[model samples]
Target: MENRQTEQAYSLYKPLLFSLAYRMLGSVMDAEDVVQEAFFTLYKSGSDHIHNMKAYMCKIVTNRCLELLRSTSKQREVYVGTWLPEPLVTTASDETDPMQSYLQKESVTTAYLLLLQQLSYVERAVFLLREAMQYDYDEIADIVGKSSANCRQIFHRAKRSLSVKGVSDTSDRSDLEKATNLVEQFMHALTTGDAARLMKFLSIDAVLLADGGGKVKALTQPLHGHLSISESISSVLKKWPGSFTCRIAMVNGLPGIVVYKDTIMWSVFSFMIRDGRITNLYFVVNPDKLTHVQ
Candidate 1:
């Protein structure tokens, strides 16, 4: 292939490749890894012939992410407790539009990504590529190495398998503003160590996931409901005897908070707000993932 043709192909397929990789890996860092590795393997490799360049490249990316995921499972298994996916971004508006986020909003909502968590890695890849990117069944089949009929069947199963908790539809400004405000209130409660204020913002069955990644001492199990989560947070703050500052920041394209020390990185929290209450909190204090803070 001529240099121009190869470059053009790269540009044309970049979005599609990122979408596939992101869906498969659920981490932008991992997605970029898969994409770059695929580019080198298929494009720079002199001996290999890439026929149907788009399909061929996507297959490489999907397979690479799957292999990485397979290898990473042992780490998750040995993890201190309930493992959650890393929150890659703070907001969609930083890179794309925020209005139709979960459309591209998997990064924003823990609920949406949690749905992917339920999928077997293959089913996750197929559903995300097809549902979000509009990849044809034939194309997905080519990438996954199955008949188109099988691809369709698998994707259908993936959809049926998803138990869409905390899922929301096309929310209007008033709705989004309401949720954003609730998050702000919750943050204020935490920052001030006000248990009474924080309790007002959480529902009875709300859950919190803290990902300190064994680097920092954090709750190993999902913190349940308003009382347990609130008392835990308030007690920690009271014991620490210092203010952990948080700023209104973009996380995965919705309202997010990046808690910090004196110019040092701390935890980041993303909200899952619904029915005027916080449904879930994804607290990411993992220093490895926090390096993405900009």
Candidate 2:
């Protein structure tokens, strides 16, 4: 009966647990593992020495996840060119509030998360918990193991630093629209073999990252320079052999282009547009990751 009850409790908290983990780690696989590990710890404890199972479990999960993030920062720094957060599919239920959900559904898209990587892990934690999850300072302090006063300070610092790093980028819908419009023109150039025009739409130091997971042939290294990116885009278009379908879709909460072949989803591409041109490109061609999504 005790074991059965534990399983029931875990089931009830699974969604919340997953959300907490995802917001912390930014990777689905890691989030799933953290939740499993948290539940394992919870089950082994046998519900003893706990006042609130929900909050206690959440604290455990977030701390474990924070530790993991702290350890992984070094690995991420040395990671392959133009690292991006793992792409996730956000559903209607993922929102914290119906109204906030409606507003943020168009705000927190995949492109937004990619930009978020520019933040330190602690800032990301504080911002996501306080802003996204609506956790109070006291609750956030519990999760982060800091004093409530310190938690507020941390969040304040995060906001100030993030402002310099483009936290306002998400709120600026006009900028996103203008940038995405340029991406559409860039894609259209691919089909029309307008190399010069395509080059015009890219920054001189533009970077292209393709997350093919080694399943398909992709640039083993990031493509750099406006000329190089233009050549690559042109070459791929020349080889594509047909009129491909492209649609503007929500990538996380940011505007992104969804690519398809026939009725099947082929790739999800998001652009990093700045200064009236695309400065970077992220192509998530990882078939396994897209399995549950598409």
Candidate 3:
């Protein structure tokens, strides 16, 4: 393809490609890098024989992500404390962001991405291509260089695993609004130290998980039970220095909070709401993972 055609292809597919990469790798920096590298490769190729620019570019990005996952597996195995995906912090003004536009909030969510991490890299690529991108099995097979039958099996296995994890579908508009309101109320209750109000918002079995990446103070283990989680939140708030302020933002495509401690980004909170109550709370405080928000 000519330079002009390649540029057009980049513009048309950048969002989709970036979304795929981000979901695959769960790192904003890595996703952006791999997508740029794919475009550069396409530009350098200057091959007119490539008839389908989208598929060609997708194959490039997917293979690159698979390679990255393999290389980084050791680092992840040794990661400090609980690991969390880098938060894709978005505000109302970010509506124009091509990547955010292409992303399905349900797929990019922290919970969903974490579940994706459970799959092998090849399964991840095939599953994402089939589920998020709506590619047919034949299409996914070509991208991942797997047989069509194998791709189909991989997609089903991945889907079954996620379903077993009780993945909550966030596609319902009313459910999303309810969750957003709960987040707002939860934030207010947190600031007010209203244990009673907080209890009402949490399921009896709610679990709290924190990620500090060993760079800062964080919980090394998951906290369970609504009562224990509530008490822990109150205790932590009382001990933390400085005045706290939180802004409700779209975190991983759901209504969540970006908390600041005297103007420094302290923590990013994402909730998994089920049955009108929070079932899981994710707190990411690692300074390294929060550079984007800072």
**lDDT tens per residue, model 1, 9-122:** 666776677656765666768877788787676556642465677777777888888899999988877877555555655454544533233334333355677678889988
Off by more than 4 A, model 1: 1-16, 45-54, 90-108, 169-171
TM per prediction? 0.86, 0.65, 0.93
Ranking by TM-score: 3, 1, 2
Please give me the total number of clashing residue pairs in predicted model 3: 0
lDDT of 1: 0.74
- Candidate 2's C-alpha runs over 4 A off are 1-20, 28-61, 67-82, 89-123, 130-137, 147-164, 167-180, 261-264
Which has the greatest lDDT? 3
lDDT of 3 by residue, 188-268 (tens): 988866667788899999999999999998898999999988888877877764477788998888888999987788899
Better of 2 and 3 by lDDT: 3
- Each prediction's number of clashing residue pairs: 11, 6, 0
TM-score-wise, the better of 1 and 3 is: 3
Candidate 3: stretches off by over 4 Å:
104-106, 164-166
